[model samples]
Target chain A: MKFTRRDFTAGLAVGITAPYVIGSARAQGATIKLGMCAPVTGPAAESGGYAVKGARIALEAVNKAGGILGKQAELIVEDDQTTNPGIVLAFSKLAAESDIVAFLGSIRSTQVHAMAPDVLKLGKPVMIGGTDPNLTHMGNQWLFRFRPNDSYSGRVIADYGFNTLGKKKWAVLHSTDAFGTAGGKALGAALEKLGSPAILDQGYANQSQDFTPVVLAIKQSGADILGSYFTYENDIGIFARQLRQLGVNIPWVGSPSITNITALKLAGPALYGTFGVADYAEESSEASKAFGKAYRDVVKVAPDNQSSWPYDAINVLAAAINKAGSTEPAKIREAILATRKFPGAEGEYNFDQNGDGLHGYNIVKNEKGTIVFDKHIEFTD
Target chain B: MNNPQFLLPNAVMDLVLQLLFTGIGIGAVYALVALGFVLIFRATNVVNFAQGEFSMVAAYLMVVFAVDLGWPYWLSFLLSLAGMALLGAIFNLGVYYPLRHRSFLPVIIATIGASILLANSVLAIYGPQPQVLEGWFETPGIQLGPVYLDSQYLLIIAVTIVMVAFNYWFFEHTMLGKKLQATSQDKEMASLLGISVSTMIMITFIYSAVLGGLAGILVAPVLFVSIQMGSTIALKAFAATIIGGFGDVAGAIIGGLALGIIETFGAAYISVPYKDGFAFLVLVLFLVFRPQGIFGERVAEKA
Candidate 1:
């Protein structure tokens, strides 16, 4: 084929751009890309580091076990900075990359809520640890939760407090954030159903320097028991110290944060007798114990819900991807939804219609600064 | 909500006293931080947005020495203050000196940039975990006739009072303090009158940083030493400074205490979730009605 001047110019143009286009395509195909949004630098940065470590561990294990879809999986993390706007920007940055078929979202419900719209727009399955009941039920099909929602935690907290502890009057204290509000509401609903509604339901802003008014309110309420859903560990630490200092020593049952390593360290003796609805109790199950040992060996720290959920999310997502034999968003969604009796570090995963994987919480006590698992409460209905 | 019967005469009085004590405790913290803001603003004619970061860096320094190295609390406290003084000197040189000839806006922006840099640098070196710093007192608190007085809070209030007296004495009596005051009042005139204007500014920065660091070290046990702790307190302290009169020392103290009391009472009587809202609402009201602040004087014409 004899080339004219015009054809020669066209061939030269193709020669220059062809290698660039092909190299980009090859890079994309080399690995199974997974995106993650975490709080690399913010109030939740400590937990975010744990989350990233958990995901990395799971990724290593997945690669060792033939990887996801017969290809080595890679995780690309973007710092959510532990803020709504920060998560939105982080999610958008990850979403802009079309090769990332699935993503790991934040454990904080508010951050997850901030990125929910973007996740829907992308139409890809995103694993999350956020436990807001509304997160799964808010018509966001792409979002799958690895942890039990607040509805179950609320029930478990209320059940353990009212029946086992034999406490009647209750004062429910929670942060005013999305997670805290929903958890508080769910706990209130559960108590009402149990015919022992809380006498004082109080909500306080996050990052509060003092909890005097809150402690005072709880004191005056004359409640025999206290139920709380604190968002940040620092807030919990402050509130717990003040609560005990103010001479109000009612039986306290808190959300998962109460059992967090940070909270335990910060509150110290103040949280000694309190109970928490933990999603990741190391002694709760064999899988949990295994994860705990592995985490302790690798991370050199006790694993909490902050790390456990991400570990479960990564493992579950890999398993679902292998089961589907495809990375298509709908196929992954179906496979994740079909996950049943899947043992995870959090609990036994049985995905419901709303994409909620775990349907229960473990009641653990802060026994002398050590989190001791008391009982596991699973719900079926 | 409190029941009407629960609000008996004794109960009401007890509640008010408790609220007042707690309010003053938290207010003292804001006052300390606000005092830092006031001193720097007075000296440089620029708002040091990094005032909060100064607190944060000092707290981290305390964590490194006291918690990580297991040093004595008293020694760690002194070392942290020393580190803050050095940081203040460097910050003056790096962030303020080059931009000193420029307008106030550049200096203010530089301080903000420095704050971000300081926060991220700490995050990079120490990681993101919040460290627990034990308070100085063995007893957590004491029950004083139906009201609880936290030991740390009592210390904070006492220190704040002492600092106020110290500041008054230092500024009004000492030759160096008079020189610093003169430089702040009229840089050109003070420079002509044989005062080292730059030296006075540097000293002001050092003093402000130490003050900020002191507040952080004091409040670390209560708030926990996290990256966000400084910013959180600083925001409230900034509002306190403005409400107290932007450049007034006494105003900062009063404004901070007033804000602390108002928010505590507001949360108690009105809404807990709107606790921060109450502080900002008061700030907005002050900004609208009394922009010059309670103690600030309005200048009729620019120099």
Candidate 2:
């Protein structure tokens, strides 16, 4: 009827502001929302599934025990595709959902590094399983590690090989990615500190079809022991088989990936008798055994660090949220940092200023396919 | 690759022999997959980016038949190849046939889309866990003097050689091969000559799919059967095709072998982390210097 400018301006303003107002209201809904970025499609899809399951199981238990802040907790997951860009994209997607109180990040250090900047920008507590020591020390307050960093793992591997196994000459083999490079360097440094430097420090690319060159380099080095940091289970499988086939059998101790279920299944007999510094050895503690049992009943498979770290991360995040009594980022951060002696599937959570939960690693061995717990090595410093 | 700088004389000899054997073995895989790319490019004048997924899909088919269903290995192998041939036909009908009238860019994009679809489809069906496929040989490997010969690698090399011979006889000496070649050269001329150009194109797709499948099946034991496996090999295979001369048969084989050897030796000598870099570096150099490839005919000469 009467087309007035004032009426049109009022209608335009209402339409423009409606979405933000409605979206903000929806963001403050009933359930507590936590976001997670896991490898739902790419090379790490299998482990990513396990991570999701672990987090789900923890959320289930938390909800059963009366939920977080007296409200039912919920988890929102995004497919990281197991790539650096994938995680960054996944993290951004989760961060955009303003209601999410916290996040569970990638187990991969490369992915964690990729998403670290976003995590810092978002200013929310991010539970991570990436073992790269620099992740916590990189001045990112929002990133909290559920697993022990590689520094502890390197030292443990070195200590076990040198003191326990009495192997002097070592060939340090690692992937060239951020995780592997940092791990290799840490192990090399640890070996040097032990006064038995690595005979050959070799770095290979991930997803390598063949490890002949690296294996041959190890063979030629005349090392009595081999310590490795492989990023993928398939690479480990190929390398382990090639190592034995090339007739260069020696005492081998490796990172957590060596003891992974995927690696065990793939490498089979090739990985037999090798030791790995695991962050979640079932026999390490009652909490670990309980989580392992629960995971087996649900997932119908033996639990590895892939599942354990996420399990611990979810549990700790839930507990921290409850302790803080609010969903505020700074309060949650403080609560997470204050968390001490909190029994988790990975280990007792004693988060230092660096946001690293467990300060030690459990050394486990592969006995003919089954991963058997050997010993636990904890560090005071 | 050259005079030993770090290794002693005897050690150098052993190292060279080992790396050479491994190089040829892995190179044979690249050659097989590259052969598929060459065939499709020659036939359709469009790169089938999904060639790698053909191998991956075949591998998963083998896992389903051989591992899951517990069928005989030989039977599974044949059945997997059959399935791949069927997939190839469907891919041709669905992806290429409709887009045949379109420009090369759309067809190329369609192939890439098909690759993503194929990968995700496998992931959806089989789940994400990488499956272990046992090698045809019971013995893992044999130590031959200084070199360790992997039985799977040996099989891959032997199969590659036989395929090279088969491809030669099929394309050069056979009537059907002549028709296929004729169609690839000029569909209109081939159709005018009473040859069904569409049929020739279909056969090329089937054959290329089978070749890609063979490569996947053979290498499954070495590299575990996974969704990403196809894409990884495809990238290197694509590089091989470019270096070998995109449409040349002999070039695919030699180029694959050359790329494998160069990367292996380069990793050993230069830097292991830059192993993939070495492969693409050679590819870049080839593109810069000999754009037509090792066996490709010069553009001016062809004109």
Candidate 3:
């Protein structure tokens, strides 16, 4: 109780650092938190499950190998409901947490677009799987794309169909949404470059119950080849069946949805012998194969872009955080932007200044319900 | 080569025929779901916003019994309908009966709330993944000359035909059906006549639920069963009901077919992106010109 010199100094020191000590203690309560907006119960819910699993698996490995900044990494997920508004709301809920260092956004381009304004407001680096070319190019510095944008997919689809299939006249079909429209334009541009401008370019709304008009037009167009960019698995499934039914069976190559598990299951034999420019072909790369084996061992399903991109996103994000040696957003963003020659389940991550990680796609063939990886097509530019 | 200027060429004829068949096929699905809407509106004097959820719930039930439990398809079909009947009863007691005396707005809002609850409950239980239901036919479709017929669509068309015939017979010939119609037309009058108005309303709910369930089951194979399936189809069905005449059964069928055909032809000739636009455009035209609907009796506005 006596006010001595040593006691006075000790009391003053304790008073100065008390709040800091309490803050540090509270922070140590759990691992580094990363938020994810996934379709927990909407049209894309099935893929949402895969996305969650992929991020967890990758994060688990990261945690085992020495957690992010020596703290175990934890994932926080909110249901996006496979809708634009749903994703925006879910992301806002997660963003309000304030403790989450970084986030993973939707795979659907439209959903990503929906949450982009809020993401910019939060000023945090968000890894997204949406392949719309405009996603990264729309001057949203905070939005980093884990998957190659649809431009690569469009080019790959057009290249494979025109060169490999040896077909000249083309019928291009696409969904009218952002992803499909960009993809169709890219495909059309590529085909024009290859001297095979599509004789027919048609756009249909998503979730169309029927595709007879589209199919009949394709048949009437007299195109020897078909190229497509579909937004949903079920839409593509319905279209595929109707196409075969209407006898419009020409050499066909489509974007990634054509090779996804849902499309394969729904379309069945109708999709046989078709080509798709998949970003995550299981046999495309050693990393892809490894991820495929790991995913199947755990999820008991074939690996596709839905799961693979998030898997890569976690791996890259964790590594970037490690390299930056901090949980600060600016440091992590720099490390991510500087990521080079980082092998991922999708492909090699060579992020550009604009935040694109991959620059090409893998072409796969659906042969009798089996997806056989054909070849990888990467562009230097 | 010498076909009339107005008449279609052979190639054009084939396209028209295919589109027409597809239009009719999709129209039948809309008609089937629209029937539930019309029936419920007739009984309750309030739109059952959850009519679509009824279809979704029944389809999920079918999936549980038929696919998950691996029961025989026919047995699953029957059990699913039975489940829907029970749900209809619960819905009447919980949703409609409680608000029987309330204005139509609150009841409509309550039905909307029920729809959200039903969809979320299923999502919580089933975890949001779309399920695939195999069609009744092993053969996907049959190619007859230039036109191909999907077996599922064919079955839907056949079922719609049977349902229309059955509805005509039931409403015209059966005492129960007449009692139900009387109750819908005038609940107090029917009760005064000792028709048991509440019982007729209960029966109407059950019948509409069953009808919605039937449409869901029939379309599941084509659309692939998902949580949003009910709402998507219901939107078009709502439009069909409007076009058909709000209270008229036959009007729903004609409206559905007409919408389907118009949309198909519009997409084929005009713009595929505006496919849904065509359906609603026709709806707008009808609303502007014929708000009472095609088959609905001329209703004088209350002065």
State the DockQ of every prediction.
0.67, 0.48, 0.44
Decreasing DockQ order of the candidates: 1, 2, 3
Candidate 2: pairs in clash = none
Give the candidate number with the greatest DockQ. Answer: 1
What is the C-alpha lDDT profile of model 1 across B97-205, one tens digit per residue? 9999998898989999999999999989988888888898988888999989999999999999999999999999999999999998899999999999999999999
Per-residue lDDT of A39-93 in model 1, one digit per residue for the tens?
Answer: 9888999999999999988899999999988999999999999999999999999
Candidate 1 TM-score over all chains jointly: 0.95
How would the docking of model 1 be graded?
Answer: medium
Could you tell me the C-alpha RMSD of candidate 2 in Å? 5.9
DockQ-better candidate, 1 vs 2: 1
The positional error of residue A192 in candidate 3, measured at the CA in angstroms, is 0.8
Candidate 3 lDDT tens digits, A1-381? 679999989999999999899678657756788999998887888888999999999998999899998898889999898899999999999999778999999989988988999998999999999888999988899999988898888888887887777889989999988888888999999989998898998999998988888887787777899999999988988888888877777888988889999899888989999998888888877998999999999999888889999999999999999999988889999999999999999999999999999999988899999999899999989
Query: Using alpha carbons, what is the TM-score of model 2?
Result: 0.95
DockQ of 1: 0.67
lDDT of each: 0.92, 0.93, 0.89
**DockQ (model 2, Cα):** 0.48
Q: Is candidate 1 or candidate 3 better by DockQ?
A: 1
Candidate 3 lDDT for residue B286: 88
Better of 2 and 3 by DockQ: 2
